[model samples]
Target chain A: MSWLHIFFALILLPAVAVGMIRILKGPTAADRMMTAQLFGTCGVAILLLLGAGMANPVLIDIALVFALLSALSTLTFVRRTWQPGKKKHDDPLS
Target chain B: MTILYHSGTFFIGIGLLFFLSGTVGLIRFPDIYTRLHALTKADNIGLGFVVCGLSLQSGNWAVIVKLLLIWLLVLIASSASCHLIASSGMEKKIKPWTRP
Candidate 1:
């Protein structure tokens, strides 16, 4: 059973790694913010898999904390960086 | 018992496949909104499967509830964060990607 779980972990970690590529060179800060969500969700899976594979139940609780707090960074990023659109019209007289 | 474990493995495999597709979409999609759409949808579904798969091995109600809770929280976070990012992008006037 543990071996089967270990197999799952091996595949799941790479999924997180693939998401990281976007974080490294994504076009904007918002794009990078998506990475935070990816990490949170993926982290939960990996932690659970690790917990199951190792027979360590604590990891699942840790994963629960990870899931609960996943949105914090994205909210902070959007508040800090994203500005409201300004309305401006080009005027010929200026 | 063996059949149950095998079924669980099958679900996990499918979840991983979706995770792969989501990452691919993230890379290939034209812009942030599209990437957000692809990832939030794909990853949530993937997590759903993974959680179900894990729950198969959970002999106790507490473990099942804990697994479900984690997936539920992730689902909410994914949708809410997607909204926050997309709205913020719109606020900042990050133009939506359009195909020529």
Candidate 2:
């Protein structure tokens, strides 16, 4: 059963990896941040599977933290980082 | 008991499929608005399925509750953040993609 749990966890890795490509190719800051959002949810799923696989409930606590922090991060990104009336061209690299 | 385990595994598999589709949409969608749609909706559902699958396999009541709570949190957070991102993008005058 642990192996089954671990196998499911392993499968989610590619989803996160593929999302990274979007970060690289993203034309806007929000695009890159969206990848970060993807990471948050994927990370939560991975952590949950690992918790079940290892029989460590502590990881569930960590998964909870992951969920909260991801929300806060995105909230900050929108309110502070992605300011209103700011031109999209304000990004230096793009 | 074995039936429960197999069903849990099936749910997890379905969850993984949702996750895969969400990732594909995030990567392939033409605009931020469309991508936000993909990320928020699909990913939250995927997380909910995973939580359900895990809770089904878990014997502990506390863990099951926690898992459900986490799902609720992610659902609320993702949707709120999605709205924020879309509105922010609009404020910056970012246009939606049109079919060519």
Candidate 3:
């Protein structure tokens, strides 16, 4: 039912919020980045469920965009912000 | 008709379980590699289940196809990013956590 879709969508919010702890305490940049990746996937799922529950087709398109943008964000982080064997703050171009 | 609805709910429930377990793993795992293993695998499976469930509930074929496409994109992106993160961690000389 529509309520089921909404329920699923709401439950996932806490999961994503809990994931943020990794970003706070993550020992390394990669660890933090992992949480971001998790966000991307979770976000897509949430949007999908919400779209179904609300009967709004446009939300699905937004979810698709969310998927692509999250991936792009991770790629940029890995290539530009993360420098292996060195502190990220030390990078000049980052 | 009712059976299809119930089954769809069942799949979504399973997907939620996977998502929870994956989050637990992300929190409890000892190392980056292990966390990545937990996350990339579990979450993708979870998303797949969710997609499957939503598609079952949906009457339109186009929505179903769109859902599947989103799942595939997330799958590919998550795995690739997982690999990139793991490799970069290795390059950084971060040692894996062994039982201590």
Candidate 4:
């Protein structure tokens, strides 16, 4: 069972790394933001798996909090990028 | 009892395979929107399978309930976040891949 937990952790690490690459190399700001959200989701899954494997119940709470924070961060990023009172035609329409 | 354990392992293996495919799709996809779709749908389902496997292993009512709740929360958040991000990208004119 512990080995299975380790397997999950191993898989999750590479997933996070790939997401980080997108965050770092994304062509646009929105792309990076989306990658960050993906990373957050992966983190929650990994945390929960670890908690179960290690027999520590407290980590479940941590995973829940991380999930909430990730959602809030995504909302904040969207709100920041799409601010109101800005002219839609600031640049010539593509 | 042995059958139950073997079934649990089989589900866990399948879940891992799906997760690996999701990762590969994320890397191979040409555009951010496509990658989001792969991860949000495929990976979310893969994680759901894993949670189910874990619940079976736990064999306790309280822990299984907690696992189910966690999976539900993750599913909802993953889809919502993907939608929010993709729509925001469209608004910004982030432009998808040109290749068909």
How far in Å is the alpha carbon of A77 misplaced in model 3?
A: 0.6
Off by over 4 Å in 3: A84-94
Candidate 3, residues B1-100, lDDT tens digits: the string is: 6787789889988998899889989999999999999999999999999999888888699999899999999998888788777777887788989998
Q: Give the TM-scores of the predictions, in the order they appear.
A: 0.89, 0.93, 0.92, 0.84
Residue pairs with clashing backbones, model 4 = none
lDDT tens per residue, model 1, A1-94: 4987888878877777878888888779777778777788778888888888898999999998888777766665655555433323441211
True contacts kept of each: 0.71, 0.83, 0.76, 0.31
Tens digit of per-residue lDDT, candidate 2, span B3-100? 87788889999999999999999999999999999999889989988998888889789999999999999988898888888878987899999999
Give the alpha carbon lDDT tens digit for every residue of A1-94 in model 2.
4999999999999999999999999899999999999999999999999999999999999999999999999988887788844554653312
Q: Evaluate all candidate structures by whole-model CA lDDT and list the values in order.
A: 0.80, 0.91, 0.88, 0.74
What are the iRMS values of all candidates? 5.5, 3.9, 2.7, 3.9
**Between prediction 2 and prediction 3, which has the larger lDDT?**
2
Best-fitting candidate, scored by TM-score: 2
| Candidate 4 TM-score, true structure as reference | 0.84
CAPRI-wise, candidate 2 is: medium
TM-score, first chain, each model? 0.77, 0.87, 0.84, 0.81
Tell me model 4's lDDT, rounded to 2 decimals: 0.74
